[model samples]
Target: MCVLKLKPAYKDYLWGGHRLVDRYNKEYDGEILAESWELSCHPDGKSVIAEGPWAGKTLEEYIRAEGKGILGENCRRFRDFPVLIKFIDAKQDLSIQVHPDNRYALKHEGQYGKTEMWYVVEAGPGAFLYYGFQREISREEFAQRIRDDTLTEVLHKVPVQKGDMLFIEAGTIHAIGKDILIAEIQQNSNVTYRVYDYGRVGKDGKKRDLHIEKALAVTNRVPLVRAKNSYPHVADCDYFTVDKLNLDGKMMDRMEGCVSEESFVSILVLDGEGTVACGKDGEQRVTYRKGDSLFLTAGSGRYVVEGRCDALVTTIRSQSAPVRIGIDIGGTNTKIGLVDVHHRLIDTVSIPTKTERDPEDVIADVGKAVQELLDLNHIPLDACMGAGVGMPGTVDRENGCVRYSNNIPWENVPLAEELGKILPVPVAVANDADCAALGEAVAGAGKDVSDMVMVTLGTGVGGGVILDGKIFSGRLTGGCELGHMAIYEGGELCTCGRRGCLEAYASATALIRDAKRAALADPDSLLWELCGGEIGKLDPEMVFAAAEQKDPAGMKLTDDYVRHLGTGIVNIVNLFRPEAVLLGGGISAQGTVLTDRLNSCLKAECFGGEHGQIPEVRTAKLGNLAGMIGAAALLVMEG
Candidate 1:
């Protein structure tokens, strides 16, 4: 059964009383029962399974055994368990303390910061707790009050009653009052900065240490205005969503819901005696009562609770879904997107590459774009799996370096290492063409196919090979330079210092060069009029447009271009024989007009002509967004 009833770990502190043992049925022989770590998986204190096949095992152990998928999709976004639930019994006034925010706590304490909510389970009459400052105070005055042992003078002490809920955000100076039994749900961290301890001494008769300087540095010195959030749940945050569940023995005996694969469910029973049933058939059951904690793994299917109970049900929400940041670096522009596990582009932004600057400067600009995209989507850095970047070059994927990029002036740049310093998550770098192929394979035109290749005929004939759904970059990550293959050896001087490479004839740049030569030679043709009699003003679109009109120069250039492109396609088909040959980039915008002619040429000249079906040549569906999306998919593929 996925549902687990837990045995809490107990803590004995000086300010604690035995109320938890007497009232909540907590089993502890210690003189002072301060807190019961009910649903914790923290290294310091983890709850054990009480009655099940997994009995005697810690929650952490059970999770490791069952696999993380049980934690559901939303909870998986967190690196560790997202929450800690506990019962706090304060016989005497607890220490006045505050917690640092994640930024400070993670830096100083190596853990998440605490943002807790207290539900007054049992509060004695005349009981009050310190919440925050009564009014705004200067830093000097706050320090003076702390030094004079009069910090409580400025504190807002709110009287508490049973069932009242108070949220204590990190950095809010607060203390639990005497004679209070509270159920606290907070971040999975144990960093506390004590402001005052009532001059209390420990068992050794020494005064407990104070964190006055740290508290002063982190505490909010302003008055905290009380506000309540309205949602279907009791409280919702990026970390967790909490809902209240109340069942009466007579009328409401059962409650049920499905725990989706996105997040695990946590049940903290405040007051209850019931059997929780979980599983597809609802046969798996575990008995629970007051002070009992239960954990239900994500995707546990259906769960039902029977008998009377007052409890808090916590689940990770969709907004906390794990995502990856994908960046596609072009010569002129860089595009970034926040892509969820499903390959959906939730949010995107584009920034100028500014490649004239140093590679580090360009990477810093990309990092800023990444941060802005995260902020726009309200996604925490921890929620992202990592960042993936695709640039035009021979990328050393293992070292995360760009070996060389002919279009962008980068050579042997450690792209990932430099970007990682600026971003919070891990960074991965690959060739931009390889990323587009991956994008098309996972989410675009070739998504359904197993083996496919993407050929982007933009500035150059850039393409990538996918074999059995994985990138087929050969040894040293250098083999998939499809454009450099010599289609006409010793014929035309190519950019790679080779003669008559595929890129020299089939690329948009190559087509433009051919068009310029043709325009100069054919002065009486439409190519001259289209370029306004200047050979430098020629473009691929003008050549194709004139060809559609059957202009002599246009038709001749189009036929030669298609023949060269078709020969390159036939070579790829005879080699790997992918399921689909996807065409992308600026030229692909011409759509079927380009594809149809290229298909005809392939059918006429391919090696296996008239014997077998040729690979379907289609325009890429993701167009300009393909590179970024593909880069994002690399995280999922590699992970």
Candidate 2:
């Protein structure tokens, strides 16, 4: 058996997908024509880990730590490696969707969100893809068509053929139709603001959620048109630059480089075979085949991809300017702050999260909170950079819509568009965990590390990732969900309708629950007495106190808890092999009492202990304010 670390599997959504047949082989050698957006491949997992301790983990987990030893080392090096690669098999029509640009993402999705390209592997007769709206529809018209189910009348459809390519920028309304296979290279995120679907029913016979208002607000009506001859189009943006190359032979391309600046490249092989030749590496070439992609880290001089097939090449460019503010929203608070262009947080503030007693009342309350913050500071909305908020869960960040947030009563709420309507500024929204991870990466312990894992030890073990210095929000916002990760079979029950999850054993809530159980079973333990003679009164802090006092029962309880935590950590480390693992939330303050034991246990459980640099178990430097700081940082970078 291969002993390795485990990584979190957030959640996956099932959509209608078509099987693709390519020249590589037959059988499963087809594309997954995405009906709805499929995330969980980048800054999360582009490729699934099929075996080892990290088996079942997303690629994002493994990439975060840059292939460091499975969860036991804490080196400071951060590798800027892209963590996601996407596949689109256009067997049917996908919804007309658009992702926000980095500015839009940072403002609305709470992170950088755009810059994507497609490499066509196969196309059926007269296959076509949707790009932008056919014409600008009035807000009233857009809403009426959405109600009338005639959204297709307003979209522009472009014919696509084999070996064709397209570069999709943020704010562009686009979709993939039937009978084509593609490899989509994009910034790691699972945010999609779908404007229209073909009224397809789900397994339960319900139509997928649609956000017409938000989509119309941000969708580009006049997107760059592509035709039969649009095979090799290059799009250059402040956040990412992409070159779509349909190569029949070896192609040599020189990338613009700056003095002492590092550049990263991702070579995606959609069909055939190819190799990336580097001059500084002494003619060393990295080879790939169909459905294969490679992330080339910063190196000097020119590079060449000499191969037998066509491929898509993507590069990230450094932003030349700076923005000054970032904003983030969460279940309990709405936060705003200031940051520099390099994504550094300088200041922040937190306000109560809208009670959202009624789902309908939540959006306006949130907007009011944001406006109040700006008003109190006497900051002009136009003068400020950008705003980012963290919605509760499973949000469509691309269009700034809250698809569904269980804790809050929101269903297809147009959060970004609504905010923009009144704020006179850009707004981004993302899941809270994703925003926190962005914050930690930009300002906290992860500042210098590009690839790292941030897990919050709270009521639930929430997770976020920074891969290649960008937050990886998976498709459907289902990435880096550590709490739901299965650590044991037939274990404790989880809130996500599952059992044996890491959260069931390791969260602060879990600790309190177990402590209460221990107190009830023994009845003689000091925990009962400390809780004022009521077992129900026990909390996580009480357990922490008991452990600190060296109570035999408390020590045993903590050991069990820590062991489970260590196991989960081991699993994440083995999968991601990140440079470091930063533990956040109130529970992380347990300090060495927790870290020392957890680290020791992890070392015992990890692969190649002592030989490999162990991942450091450090508390988050930003504390509860991390989410706020991160949101602010995201907005500023985007603004």
Candidate 3:
């Protein structure tokens, strides 16, 4: 009931060729195949369910039978299905066109606006497309240029190749150039305002109609200059969020992910083939190749992709607009964030954590700070679902007690009970590492995985384990003590009075400590030069920087560090066998440098090696805010 395979509604536009029919295996009788509405619910052309008992049913019919609830809470905001996915083949130039915004479209056309993104599948040599105007032009000039047949002269032509992605907002004049094929994800509406046709005639021997006035009214006169930001999403806007995935078959051939209750998932594969399954046992599995569209209902929970392919995953990140509060307690400062149902961190505030003060006084200060945070965002105290706190040490989640926290240097603090007394809403407390791991599982690097282990290599090697979409905090003492696990038998003294623990060898503090020793030992080495010949000035980055420079001392330090960390991680893999091992904290910023080495190390040292499912090593996406957002989620998540 969760997974659905679709058969597209094909279109034979005048400018199209048989590329889709010939190369893409589109079952079409026409000579030209311009577009295939791969996963549509539009009345103009609906995609039919292509398999099982639903074989002959249109997607709309299937939705009507299943009820709209299957679309997830987020889709309830829209009047109909929010998105339409298709594959477009432009054998010749498509007409320069524009689409109206929602307001205009709803008012004049009674449909949603068109805001689309194009993922180039194939581009022949010298292929180019008109994006927008090169420079801002007046309405009079625009009209005159079209009348004079000089419109293309003013348009911004972009030379395109395979793999390029372009986001086209409504009202941006654009045209697909000849010999280009692409996958398009857009609003469900098909309201188009063809503005220019290059004097082409149809079967009736008449030029295509152009909505000049409507196009003028909606068209953005100013040149569109797309500004790229640092957000991880491919195309994140109010309507939809898109993410690209690739399984190269060697390094990655399988992807395991979870579909939360907030949004349904639409995966449109652009290249390669593989099995797409829902649930752990593959009950709703489909063996599909390229040009396939797979839909997973909301809360499908566990979905797997096993194949060599590049696909774009589209989902609605926002839910029904419920917001929750999250608090992350660190040694120096605490971060507070608002998490909406989309599992995204909406807003964040920070305050210094004066641990030297009385615990009750500090708790009172946190309450005051929470009120200030709500007031600043113009949110009422009762507006939030609840508040969740992530503490630095072992947290008794059920009893809301801080049993023992070496970082906060506190024991037996009733955090949840006290915070609840003031907040007037449900409050949940959890270990800081657990919160980070949960956040990653819910929305970050481990968002798609059911089983995940997050290791935070910070001041101490902190870790959390996620099993089947929930935190695995074993006992009241806060289990999954990943860092305390011994790496070397009685080799090094750990801060927790343990001998040869991972925390003593794998943490950033440990790295810096070793760097300082190496600097003192080798006064003439690059480690000393990077740390300015001062042993006390040595930091973790200085060690990695020296290693990046290929210094012998730095190489030795990094090699030993990775070896020690790798041994501990290998043990984690052999034990948990999670889909991914997410690395967080300041040290994870090293990106591929650290993960690449660890993956290689895991390959060599893991018990089964390549014969088993090797967990991919990736950097945690949410970064420092993971704890805060994940803490907020605890108020809504199942234990």
Write down the worst ten-residue block by lDDT for model 3: 222-231
Residues 1-639 of candidate 1: C-alpha lDDT, one tens digit per residue: 578889998888899999889878898998999999998999889999998688899988988987877788767657788889999999999999999978798899899998888889999999999999988898899999989999899999999999888888888999999999999989898899998999999888999989999999999886664344626667876777888999988899999888888888889998979988999788788888988898888878889999999998888786533689999999999999999765779999889998899999999999988988898888888889899899987899888999988789999999999999989688888888889999988888888787998888988788999887777888666758898888997967888899989999988899999998888787877988888877888899999989988999999999998888888888999898888898988888888998888788778877768797788888999987888888987786742
lDDT of model 3, residue 227: 41
TM-score of each: 0.53, 0.49, 0.55
The order of the candidates by lDDT, greatest first, is: 3, 1, 2
Residue 16 in model 1: lDDT: 94
lDDT of 2: 0.64
lDDT of 3 by residue, 1-639 (tens): 788889999988799888888877788998888999998998889999999898999989988998998889888879989999999999999999998888799899988999888889999999999998998899999888878889999999999999888888888999999999999999999999988898999868899898888998999877754443316887877678889989997799999988888888998888788898897687888977888888888888998999897898999866333779999988889888988765777788899888898778778878888888888888887768889999987788888889988767788999888888888888899988899999998878887678999999988899899988789978546578999999889978999898999999999989988887777777777977776666788778888899999998899999998898899999999999999999998888888999999999999989888899899999999988889988987886775
Clashing pairs in 3: 257-448, 258-448
Candidate 1: C-alpha lDDT: 0.87
Runs with alpha carbons beyond 4 Å of true place in candidate 3: 1-321
State which candidate, 2 or 3, has the greater TM-score.
3
